[model samples]
Structure formats: C-alpha cells, structure tokens
Target: MAFGADELRVLRRALATVLHPMPLPDEDVQDCLRLAGAVDEAVGEAGRMRAFLLADLARYRGALPGSAAGYLELLQDALVGGYDPVPDDLAALRALRHRPVAAALLERCRTATERSVRSRLAGRAVPAPAPRGRLLALPGGRAADGEPERPKTPAAPPGPAVPPERPAPKPSEVFPPRRRPVPPVGRRVAG
Candidate 1:
C-alpha cells in the first residue's frame, strides 16, 4: 500500500510518543488511538497472511519428492511471512518450475517484483537540466558567468581614422583603471 508524506509523519510522531517513557497527556489521547489502531490492524493482517503462506508452502512441499519434503517443511516453518522469500526458496522453486503448479507461483512472484520496481521508479520525478544557451540574464548587464560588461565609454573619441592599426596596448593602458581604496579604520562611508 501507498502512504502520503503527511500520513507517514503522523504515524512516526505517534510511534515516538508511544515509545517514550513519559506518560502521555490527556490532550494527546487521539495520537494514542491512532497508534493502537494502526498496530492492531497490522498485526491482525500479518497473522492472516502467515496462515496463508504456511498453507501454500505445505501444499507445494507435498508435490515435491520425499528427499525435498523435510527441507521444504523446515523452510515453511522458518518463514516469518512479512519479509521477502529468501534466495534458497526462489532457487528451489526455479528447479521445480517444470511442474505446472510451482511454475505459476514462481512467475507471479517475479512479476510482482518487477511491477514494484517499475512503480517505485515511475513515482519519482527526475528533473531535467535547463535547456542549453537559453538562460535568462540577471539585471545590470551581467552574464551568466557573473562578469559584467564594461561600459562603451563612447569608443575613445573615434581614435585616428587611418593610423594603420598599431600593436595592442598593455592591459593597464587599455583602460583608466584605479586601485580599490580601503575604508578608514572605524567610521563608515556615506552612500
């Protein structure tokens, strides 16, 4: 069965309260009720399921040869019914698939495992990455790389129109750059 997040949270909170040493307040009696009801239902359902599984295991064992009868009966009694069937049970069943009765149950168990896996995968949402080259730019002419564009400064007054293109100037000479002045020891600067 499936449970919502809120339901699971409530169940966990109820279990914590019930398991604590302190006595619960009268106001929290509703939580006690929920815990008791959930526990009782689970135990009752498990008992019924255990009976069914033991019966099914016995029926399967009866069809096997005398050599396997003892082992099958031992495994049937060892089963707790809530947990998964062990590797040995599956392996034994695989060897017995030539028989019609064992083949159906083995196929059903495999199908159930596959369906559960597929359902779990389908329930999750795998978010895709944002499409390439389509990101929205932030304000103030900043690129996605966080570098801001340098202002145009009107193209250096049109330079010399036909000076034959001299070699590039040094990086410091290319712009009027200045050292970032630090603040005074205590008082702040006004905006």
Candidate 2:
C-alpha cells in the first residue's frame, strides 16, 4: 500500500512515539487508528486479489498452449506479488521458452522456485508425535476379556536404571543444510 505524504507523516510520528511514548493528542491517536485500519484493509484486499490471481493462473494453465499468452502474463503479475512457481509452471515455462519473454520468465521462476524450496527445508522440522501412555491390565491382573491371564516366560533382568550418556548431535547434523542442485554444464534438463 502506498502511503500518502500525510499518512507517512502520521506513521513517522507514531513510530517515534514507540521510543518516547507520551499521551498522544486526540487528533494524533485518531490518525494512528485510521492509518492502522487502512493498512489492515490493504492487507486483506491483497490476500483476496492474490487468491483470485492464482485461481485465474490455474485456469489458464489448464488450457496449456492455447492459453500460454494469458498464463505467462498472469504468472508475471503473480511473481510480482510474491507467488512461488509450482512444477507445472516451471514445465510450462520451459516448453514456451523459445519466446524471449518466456525464456526470461523461466529463469526468474526457477530462482523463485529454488528459493521457496530451500526456505521450506531450512524451516523447523516436523514435530514428533506425542508418546502414548502405557495401558495397565485389569484389576487382579486379569485380561479385559474376562479370561485368566496367561503365564509369561521368564525374561532377562533389567539393565542399569540410568541409560548410558551419548553425545548430542549438532544443530547442523539434526537438519543438514541443503543446496540447490545445479545441472552439469552443457546438459540442459527437459521439463
């Protein structure tokens, strides 16, 4: 959202208040509230527009070569809005790369796709599932089915109560750094 001169002035004042907060005048408070509301509305509108653009891009993509022109246009706009190209988009761009525009877009899309993938990999790992609690036998050590418990064979004795200490892995080891794969020189990959 582009802020007007007046809005920018108000924004600067509001930010300054953060470091040296005093009772803001009623006029300044109103301006700040209005600016915040405008920002929220702009953000919501951008999200809705992005969703619509993506849906349109998908429809154009589904049409393939026939809709190549429209798809490329929509993709360029979407990229400006921070859209990440999917595999289908990359394939389509590669197919149309004979055109100068498509060739440039293919390179741009590849960079954006790689960046998106690396960011996902660098993010936190999936959390492990919670451990389940042990279930106890029914009262009197009988099975839940009202049957007598079977006699168990003797088992080996337990080891030491405390487990042996082991060195913890480094953070890098837990989530090894990933690098984007580079195709060998002079060998272009299709699709």
Best by lDDT: 2
Scanning candidate 2 in windows of ten residues, the lowest lDDT window is 129-138
**Over all chains combined, what TM-score does candidate 2 have?**
0.56
Please provide, for model 1 over 51-163, each residue's C-alpha lDDT reduced to its tens digit, 9 standing for 90 to 100: 66555565565556543544343343433122244454567768877766556556755665465567569994222111222112122222223554434333223322323
> How close is every model to the real structure, measured as TM-score?
0.28, 0.56
Model 2, 1-191: lDDT tens digits are 46799999988887776666555565776677688677767556555666787998999999989987778888887776556788999999999999899999999999887776776699933222122222221122223335555554443454324323544233233322334445668967799
Per-model CA lDDT versus the true structure: 0.46, 0.67
Error of 1 at 144 (Å): 60
Local distance difference test, candidate 1: 0.46
- Separately for all candidates shown, the number of backbone clashes (residues 3 or more apart, or on different chains) is 0, 0
Give the clashing residue pairs of candidate 2, or none. none
